[model samples]
Every structure is written in C-alpha cells, then in structure tokens.
Target: MKKTGLTIAAALAGALLGSPALAQKTVLTVGMQSTDAGVLDPHLNSGTPGKAMLQWMFNGLVRIKPGELSPEFMEPDLAESWTSSTDSKEWTFKLRQGVQCHHGYGEFTSEDAVYSLARAASKETSAFSSDYAAFDKVEAPDKYTVKITLKQAIPSLLGIVMNYHGGNMVCKKAAEELGKEGFAKKPVGTGPFMFQEYVPQQYAKLVANPNYFRGKPKLTEILYRFIPSDSSRDLAFQSGEIDMMLGRQEQAWVDRMNALPGVKVVAMGPAEMSMLHLNMSQPPLDNLKVRQAIAYAVDRNAIWQFRGKNISRPAVSVVPSGYLGTDEKAPLYPFDLAKSKALLAEAGFPNGVTIKAINTTLPSMLSFTEATQALLKRAGITLEIQPVEHATFHQQIRQDLSQVVHFQAARFPIADVYLSQFFHSRAIVKTPTAVTNFSHCKVADAEIDAARSETDKAKQLALWKTAQEKIIKEVCAIPVNEMMQLWAYKDSLDLGYDLKASLNLGPPVLETTRFTK
Candidate 1:
C-alpha cells in the first residue's frame, strides 16, 4: 500500500508540472541602451529607448501595420476610418467606439485625440513641434469625430498623424488631472500594457492591460531594464535573464550572437542615415573651402564596411537612399585625401585644421565618430571629440555648442521632411523656430519650399532633386552610411509577426507575443 501511494504521488507531481498554465511564460524582460527615460509622455519624449517603451503603452489614431516600416502600410488603430478633402488640406478621423483607456482612465474619444494633437503641435510641449507647423487647427466635431485643417497639403497627412514621434495619443482626462510632471511619470493610454512603476536609472515595470481593446495580452508583465553597457546587456541575454536586447551594430557582434544556441539576431530597415553637419555659423566651418575639405575626408564605403553589409549601406544623397523623391544621382564628394589637403591649404590652413564636436558616449555613435576621427587624421585634420552622456550630447549640440555635428536619424522616409529639417533656414539651431538645422544650411530653402506644395509627382521629385544638388554643391553636410536596426532575442519567444522593420526603432511586443515552450 505504501509503495503504490508513493508511486501515485510522484505521477501527480509530474502531471502538475506539465500542465499548460504552469509551463507558459508570464513575464518578458527587455534590455535597452539607456540610463533612464527623461519622461514617459508620448508627446514629450524623443529618445529611442523612451520611444520603445511608449510603443507598448500608447496607441495613435493610425499606426504603421505591425512589422512594417513604410507609411504606405499604415492602418487604422484608434480611428476606425478617415477621410480627407480633395485638396488634402482638411482631414476628418472617426474614433473607434467603446475603446477603453488603461487603468480605468475611461473610454477614448475625439476629445483625447484633439487634445493630443494640439499638445503635440505646441512648441512648449513637444520636441517635434516643427513636424506640425502646417496645422491650422484641430477640433472635435462630435464625441467620435476629429477634424484637422492644414495650412498646406503635405506629401502624406497620415505620415505625421501615424503612431510615431508626436503622433502617439494620450488620455485627455488623465493628462489634465495628473498635469505635465505627474502624467509623464504615470501615463494613461489605450494599449496592451499600462505603466506600473518606474525607478530612475534602474528599470520600468508595466502590467498587462486586461481591458485592452484587441484582447488581453498573453504575458502578465513586461520589465524594461536599462542596461547601457553592451557587454552587460549581452551577458544578461545569454544568461536567460533578459528575453531580448538591443544588439551592437557591428558584423562581429551579429555573427557571434547568431552562432549562440537558441539565439536569433535581427537586422532590418528602414535604416538611420548618419550625416556630418558642419555648423556654417561657426568660425572655422563658416569658410566654404574648409567645409568642402571636411566632406572630401569622409569615406562612406569604409563606414559601411565597418558596420557590415547586412546592417549598413553607403549613403548616396543628402536624403537617405530609399526615401521618396531621393535622387541616387545626386552629386557626392569622393574620398580624396589629396583633394582634402589642397582645400585645407586654399582655406589658409597650411598645416591642419582642428574641428571641435560634442559627441555621444553611446557605443554605437561613439564608435562611428571615432572611426571618422581616424580617417580625418590621415588627411591632416584633427577631429576634437568631447564625449558626453547621450542626453547631454543632444542638448548641447542643439544649443549650437558643437562646431561639427554628427547626427544620425530616420525621418518619415520623405525628401521634404529631411531637407526642410536639416537644410532650411527656418530650422537653423538656436533660433525660435529651430528644428535641427545644425549646419545652419539655407542654400536649399527655395527648392525645399517649392517641393512641399507641389501637386505634380514629377515636379515634386524634381524640386527635391534640386534641393539635394544644392545642399551637396555647397557641402552643407557630408552624407555617411545608413545603419539598420539590430536586436537579438531568444528563439523560443514567438513575436507573433515577421520581424522586418519597425518605425519605433525596436522590436514590437504585441498582445499575441508569447513563449512557445
């Protein structure tokens, strides 16, 4: 009797362990390269890591189709349907009824949409206010309808309104009640995840939203860990402490991670174009010959090789290659050390030129800047790099503290957006309407303005090409290589969709994501 009872007990224990409920994974931990988020408010935060966290906690009226990067694949999210005027100056969006906000924040309505749009367009609130400069007004006609009037028709109204940058919506009532500071710390939105807690320089904890519009998420919770160090983050992922991590943008790192058992490395687009913007307002760079010399010193092919062919490609124009209206034939300065030296001599710098820059300490950015430094040294140009924390680097550079600014960014995949932000006079840094014109480049302003309202597709493309030609001729900025997004995850984790590209610049963890084991 004792032997039989023991045998039954052992069998029961094994059965309990093998049950479906006990075998499923309930939590997922993601490691990102950031010390901590400056804020959680969708309209205010601009850091890549902050954007990744916001993706889980918020939803825009329209969103890029999951696992896709282009605006052409955008589909309705909070808004059920939308219509625009023939001129494309006016747009009306119909909000989905019965969509509930996280944490009992009440249902989403047109009021929230209007409030969020106005907030994002305000320079006092959003970092991307320039993107909405064409907006005349945003109003709610009814409880479920939102109307927007633009001063001028853009290439795609949906590009600015989709779930990216300033487009992510927030709970109107929650924002009003919590105020700016409180709401940033504890945001309320309508998505699969809800903010639970945030520890500075540590981690952010989010819980599954049971009242999610689509459905309850399979995972019980998500812990977004802040592991800035590459080696530490990689070790955590290898030790099974983190389910996913942002991988280094190097071929060696990708090869090493891919070889690991049960580890999957993802390299996808659309890539960020890394460009070196010489501040023309600054003394040394103000000289045209000096600017041209710096351009001749950079080797685009060398940079692309350093980051591997799978993850990077040489940039062909001022605007990223693959963007709409980009002219592949746009003139580029070839890498000629002798030409660089001659130009420096003609500029009255017979010995060498020393250019100062405030650069980011982030491994990915620092590595690129250091490589440029080595290349410039060979051409008798000294690149003085002062490395600071990532956040500080962005702050100081925008304040016009850097003589040379190496900015890497992926915009709305449109020539107008890139040209206007980087070369138009209105966006010159330190000015009231400044966006990111670090070079203080105004040569392409005419072509950029013409292209914005051009109704004809061919005419618009021609205008954009002219703008690129002007920017390149003046040597306003040297186009470097484009670096694709890279990340690694465990093979057992099912992301529920093909991992192609994400505008959020990180892996998308949806409600359907789960562990197969």
Candidate 2:
C-alpha cells in the first residue's frame, strides 16, 4: 500500500485501474464525533467536518501550507505565483498550466477564480458566503491571471484565502450553466479526489480524481463515516472498525486510546480555547462593570482542575497564546469573588442576575459547563444550564442569539483569522441584515474597519489591541482556558495534526501522507 510521494497518482492508478494482480483500492474509514447531516453546501455548513470534506473534494486558487500556520500555502496548486501590494490591499495571482477541472468542467482559468470568489462573496449563494464584506472585487484579467481588490489592507488576507470556506474553487461554466442546484448535485473540482456519492448522515463517498493536476491519490476510495457519539467512535476505533478518528473531547479518553494496543493518539498543541461567553446584547452583560466583574470572578485554575494537570492552560486574552498579538503583559482577570459581587451591585443586580448558559452535549464540554456553573455560583450569579446537541447548538447560536453560552473557540495560526471571525461584523455568526452587532457589544464599527484596513503589522497589532481592550472592558466574551485536540490512529498511519484549522484537514497534507500496510 506504500506509494512514493511524487508518484502517488501513478501508484494509485496502477493499484486501482491498471494492475490486474493488485487488489482493490484500500478504503480508509474516518470516524468523527459529528455528522454532516444538515447541509452539504460548503458556505452554509457551520461544522468543521463538513468544511474538511469539501476541502478534499475541491481545489482553491490558493491553499494552506501543510504543517505551518502562517496563512500561506506553499506549492501553489491552481495559482502558481501570487503577489500582494505593499499596503496588502490589492493582490493578483497567476494561474498554473495544464490544470483540468474534474467532472468535465474543463481547464483551470481566471474565470473560475472570479466565479468562485464572487460566488462565495454573493449573498444569493449561501454556500459561498464569507465575512469578507471588505472584498471589493475579484476580476479575471486573462485566462491565467486573477486580480483581487479589497476595501482595506488586511495582513491576514492570505489566511482568509486559505480559510476552509473561502479556499474552495468552483467551475465557472458549471456553476453558471447549472446554477446552485446543478453545481451542488454534481460538483466538480481539480482535486486529488472526486465526489462519488453523498449519503446524508451516513457517509460522503469519494473516488480518485483521474484528471487531478497532481495525479490520483494512493487510496482508491475515502469513506468519511459520520459517527455521532464519542463512545461509538471510540468503540469502533478499538474494535478496528475505522482507520482514523477526527477529534476527541477529553485527554483521558485520548490517553486511553493511546494505551490500546492497536491505536495511538495524536495530540496537537493549543487546539482550542473553551470559554463561557456572556451576551452583551442583554441588560446584565451590557454593563462593562458587570462584565469586568465576571471576568475577574472566574477561577480558570479551579475550572481546569476537572481536566487535571497539563491538560489546559488559563487564558488572559480572547486570542490564545500561540497566535500573534498575545502579550504576557495582557491583564489576566484573576479570580476575585469580592470584586464580582461589588460589580454586580454596581450594575444594579445586587441579588444576582439569572442567566441561561447553553452548551453542547460533548462530554468534556459538559464537565467544563458544570465547572463554570460552580464558579459563577461563587460570584453569586445564578446560572441555568441548557444542553443541546453539537449540531443543534451550532444552529441555535446562529439563530436564537442567546445572552450566555458555553463556547469553545479554536486557535488559528494567524491573528487576523481569529480576530475577523469573532470581532468583524461581516462574520457569519453575526446577522448580515441587522446592525445590532452580533457580539452585542458597543464596539465602534469604525475601529473594526480600521483594524481590517491596517496592513502594517505593528499598527494592525495595535489596532487589534485596542479592539481587544474594548471587547474585554465591555465583557463581549470571557476567555476561559486553552485546550488540546487529540486524534487516534494506527501506528502504520503517518498523520500530521496541523495547528491551522485551514491546513490540518485539507488536501495538501493528505496528499503527502503515506500509510503503511
């Protein structure tokens, strides 16, 4: 089953369709905690798993680097050379040669880039939507050259391009000729794999892409099995039912996985930050004094005590440690019950404010939520806990717009991705129509705009710092602690866990992977 890196497509082709002596292609069954049961539309789907699946089945002009988190993907697949203006507001890309689209979609062209980006930017196509409201235009100068104009200079432009939702490239002719339904039904891409079938809630079946610019994949078929429960996924992994597991909630479970004779757990550093966010749209959270008090009240050490030593680290800023602009000097809101009570009284809630804290049914999150409840109780705040399914909770966060919720925000390689996703008004979580400001805070839109436009690294950092101060002072979202991501696989499998959300689960790394049989 071993295939050389340079000759992967040849090896797979020989194994799958060419060699008579070779057996059928090996199918890797990947187990995950959640399912892509709702929407296959890449733009509309909020889950990371869905984004990962789409990534394998499509190709973008630019991609994320395999193991790095700097927002630039080396070895351009579609676009060979990309240059950005000194100010970083404008960018242009030169497309590669001999790149053919799968499913009879035709060759790679600047039109495809324009069509794809425009589609993602369009409000009509929900699947291609993004927080890139600042994107002014995407134009095709020639068949192989594409130019992009942004409203502001953002250092994270490359990071945003490599974003899971934004990175997928679409066929211009197929997209226009077939429309949304046509494109969705039989999507085409110039990737290593081709979409064979999608059985909602079961699996997304894919075969090797023959017209893939690079070549065919080593594996004949990839079966992304959507296993809903952690217990089921763990049991399946233990029983040798699946080849790989995507993500695990608790370190103990991941440790247990490593102890198993056939499985090994892969731990990625600073994967996520789990926190209890207060809704600034509400009356109690609207008061900066009360928000500061809540930030001061929580004992992150005690909360992480449930997870044990080395499992989690206390977070001082909304952005985690690994990302840029995380200063050690940033004030850490140490636990102070006295301050919490005083601030609550100052906010006119002397008795305490009753609030609902919503969370998903993930086991580790349950423990984290309970710990938050206990901590808030010490501050004389009454918390009503509500647990929902992960998929449902993701949907609820988008729809109901609650006051308080148990949230786990992931850490990206770049600060811009982190800042833009949560802070920017253009992000998907915020309602596009409403000017209410989704974090429900009193942040100056003009400040966010300035941060988005500032290209100078130091100046951008300063702008982000200002915004962070405003967010913290207003108590937009409380930073809890940073957590790790764990994945278990057979030792025969050589899988690298990528720190950047855009890169880890994408095609470039997957293409380089070689599994021993």
Q: What local distance difference test score does each model get?
A: 0.89, 0.67
Clashes of 2: 4
Q: How does model 2 score by TM-score?
A: 0.86
Q: Where does candidate 1 have its weakest 10-residue lDDT segment?
A: 156-165
TM-score, every prediction: 0.96, 0.86
Using alpha carbons, what is the TM-score of model 1?
A: 0.96
RMSD (Cα, Å) for all candidates, in order, is 2.0, 6.6
Candidate 2 pairs with clashing backbones: 9-216, 43-127, 65-73, 120-128
Per-residue lDDT of 326 in model 2: 57
**Cα lDDT tens digits for candidate 1, 85-154:** 9998999999999999888889999999999988888877777788888899999999999999999988
lDDT of 2 by residue, 11-66 (tens): 67777766654544266778766755355555455455666577776766766555
Candidate 1: C-alpha RMSD to true structure equals 2.0
Ten contiguous residues minimizing lDDT sum, candidate 2: 500-509
List candidate 2 stretches off by more than 4 Å.
1-25, 72-75, 126-130, 181-187, 308-311, 425-430, 433-437, 495-509, 512-514
